[model samples]
Target: MQPGQQPQPSGSYYPQQAEQYAVPPMIVPSQMPMMMPGQQYGQPPNVPQHMLRHGYIAATFGTYGETAYCAFLKCGLGQIPLMFSIPGCTGAYTVAQSVLPHLPYGWRAADGAPVILLDCIIDQTRGPVVPQEVWMPNSPRVYDQHVVRAVLRPPTFFVHTDGSVGLPLPQILSGNFAVNNANAPVDVGRSSIHLHIKIHGYTDRKRQFQTQESGQWIQLRRLVGHVGRAVDKYLREAEPDPEQPVPRLRIGAGGIVPADVVVVGVVHVSSGSWMPILQLTRALA
Candidate 1:
């Protein structure tokens, strides 16, 4: 099947004679509002609509360079958008639409001016549901300001999952998952079926608040270190230092500093009745 095309049942996940999975047609970008940076377009606040709150989690980062491989995510922006009918709710959710940031390597807030990128919209419905219109930020809720820090350095692009360059002692990657189905099927009485959903992606460089004198994009360095080092200091303090004679030295070789960069974590959503405890599976998966 094509990358975007939904896979037809070869009797794998579903029965061959059973009805093919229902997949909504793709929504054309043109029919939707023209999504461009600095362009004003969105639905009015007065319009009655279901609000979905979403958070981006980093899945993985392989390298650091001009063209590093990274992945960002778009989850349900509101509370669970879809649910299963079973007493324990269970089912699958295909991404219908999403709005993501067009972040590229080396793209910094200093070089990007206001540091605000375009709001990408992905409509995953069968047809156009709303008219195309430009958005004006007249209220706080409609266009909320999300101040994120670009804490990590530009990702180096030499790493791969194949263990080609000799696996690093510790593997660190960032990304998140979006699960629409939570409950289980109601008809399962004598049979046992398991469903495991895993979503992984690389973390992208986000814009910071700082700007260059020319009004171009410039990044703040301190923010980057904050996300990278804050945890280490916490761990050091928790460790038993036998040589420590002074009462918690504030200034020392290992000092705890807040990270400035926004370290995005790659998220995984795994669910099943006997799906090996959530914490254990995530640690190993």
Candidate 2:
């Protein structure tokens, strides 16, 4: 094939064009056609074009339509490993030749999901085309002198509602604020700052139950923003600011105090193919 002349289609992953191969199967390095030293391979090959030469390269999605594996190869040529993200999805693939060459051999996810390795190095003497984020604390933005230790202070209960007595229950939580009263409706103002919390137990008489009654504890998840709003709603009368302020929530007579406040997340993995060259580069890195 002449330079820049597109090769014939292998197959496609799309349902309508199902016969077209998006990415050709991986080729073992030992099986690759060997060229003798000083032989005319012409000039040093462009990685992406070299991928094109192989035929049936694959790709994943992005904000733009059907982005092929260009960036993956770029990372390989740069001797860097990177992750390719396709939003709202666990797997996706595209078709093209040579695109697979950038991927690594024997690449598989430790988590047993599909992944690709990209390994090729580009000459950086020409200057980097893109900059990576590097953390530098003393880089002209802020100058630091010495380290100092500040004593941890107790939670400040600034907003106390009238007609309600506030009792700071120190035994309930160490270095944290807790409010309790036998009767007069305790309004613990949500501190303006967000907090991480877990409800160890609660006492209720009429329901005749406590965290001890049921051995099982209910796990509650809360976001900082939502928790702030809930606190504002419950302690409405105690809010220091009235404009755009949320009220404190009132815990009902029979309602249970939340078990905990930390949020949990899940990661789902689906099966798919990734560029082998990209996979290889990542593995070596």
Candidate 3:
């Protein structure tokens, strides 16, 4: 067929005026023609142009919608192996032909579910994407630098209503900031300035929620803006004590916190509000 020239239909061609006909039986995987090296599996050479145009490819080869398989392909991995095993089956042929092109390089299905790749582990309990360590055979220096950077950085905290905090930002951002009161609340009167302010709710009037059901944590950069507003509200409500030096909160153009204060933890209230706890230290002279 010429490039972009629509192929004409042959054999039992149903014109627009033809009466409805019975649907054909589905072709099993074994009955489908073997895919040539350069040919796309679904678009087999033997299949009629009309059948391929009507999505017979998917119907004949089965669905290509496996989660892990799709994710593996999205990461730019090549074709799935033909000899691997799948759960409840002995060989790869049991899997749909369409899904075969998307499976991870060496991974297989387990209990009819996608097996996690070693370089990208999925946390089943938390249902959150967790970072995995990747090894680079040829780039040792780059890998070492990445490891050092990851280790030195502190985890982002999510403050709960009861003045407790959760570590690592991902869970909190995903709306899992439930209250954990084990950790003590920061003492505001300590020698070092530790700013602990309860985030009651959004300052935006239109987005306000009940005090009991507030505190879903967003990105830390956005949270800093809310913190600024909270501090302003506190300053307006209370009288200025002469002995206490005003705590200065400075965020750089790129949202880097000044050295004086470090974010410690985020507390989620029973009512679903989030509070941020910051530990303040003397800035370098």
Candidate 4:
């Protein structure tokens, strides 16, 4: 093979092709190959043109699109280590090839499914031509500052009808998050969100609060962006703006609330219609 010349297909090419790969539109690192030490920025020949490289993927869906290892994630319930696969290619690099994200414990119910926000860090610096597959499937944009991201299964891309997430990609997530109410009639676009998240059983300091002297705008910084729009890019472009409300994790003057009380909220996407807005509510039974 020569520079810019595509390599021959591997035996599993059909399976690979059948397995659709989508890079979320969120913050992604440059797909341009990162040069090895002592090599000129664009010079060739650190290795053989015929040399092949291997990469890995942890996915919710699989060959033939059966939601293979992510069976439990279908209804947004259950827990298990994510499924991953490793394969070789003529030009690519792999880091944390065995990485897998675990679902948070105890989030299943009937009234609704808990919205799980996801993200990850993807670096594709070793491929010369194509982006070497550092992606988070369902996240919104591709910012180097923002980690890579994704969702359980498309379930229609699992994105809101309004496109709140920005772009679509398959997901395995990371980062702090929040949610929208599942039973809402519409987007329920709330301007403010306050969540009493379960930190830990022993966490004595709960309920975030700002000093009386602080302005409401100043308080917005303490709270993370809405997790329902957890993967959206608008939150990252600039400093926190109070107008775009976020989930405030307050520390009450009375101290921490009991951890046994589980609170979970999510923006729901069903067959077609979607309600992506969120508000604080008790965990569904």
lDDT of each: 0.19, 0.21, 0.27, 0.22
Prediction 1 TM-score vs. true: 0.18
User: If both were scored by TM-score, which would come out higher, candidate 2 or candidate 3?
Assistant: 3
How well does each candidate superpose onto the true structure, as a TM-score? Answer: 0.18, 0.17, 0.19, 0.17
**1-285 per-residue lDDT for model 4 (tens digits):** 233332232222212222444421111124324454567766663331111111111211112112211221332112212211112111221112112223331121223333222211122321111111221213223311121122222111122223122111111123222222222222211223222211111121112222123222212112222332332321122233243243122222232122211111122121111112111111211
Q: 1-285, model 2: which lDDT tens digit per residue?
A: 344443332212111212222222333233333333344666543333333322112211111101233222222222222332222222111222233342322223444444432222221112111110111113222211110111111111111122111212221123232222112221111122122221111111111111111333211111112332332232232222333232121223222122211111100000111111111111110
Per-residue accuracy of model 3 over 146-260 as CA lDDT, tens digit each: 2221111111233334433223333323434443332323211112212234211111111222221133323343443344444444323433334323312223333212322
Candidate 4 has an lDDT of 0.22
- What does candidate 1's lDDT look like per residue over 195-256, in tens digits? 21111111112112221334332222222222223323332343333443332212124322
Give the Å error, residue 218, model 3.
Answer: 3.7
Worst 10 residues of 3 by lDDT: 128-137
Candidate 3 vs 4: which has more lDDT: 3
Clashes of each: 59, 49, 15, 32
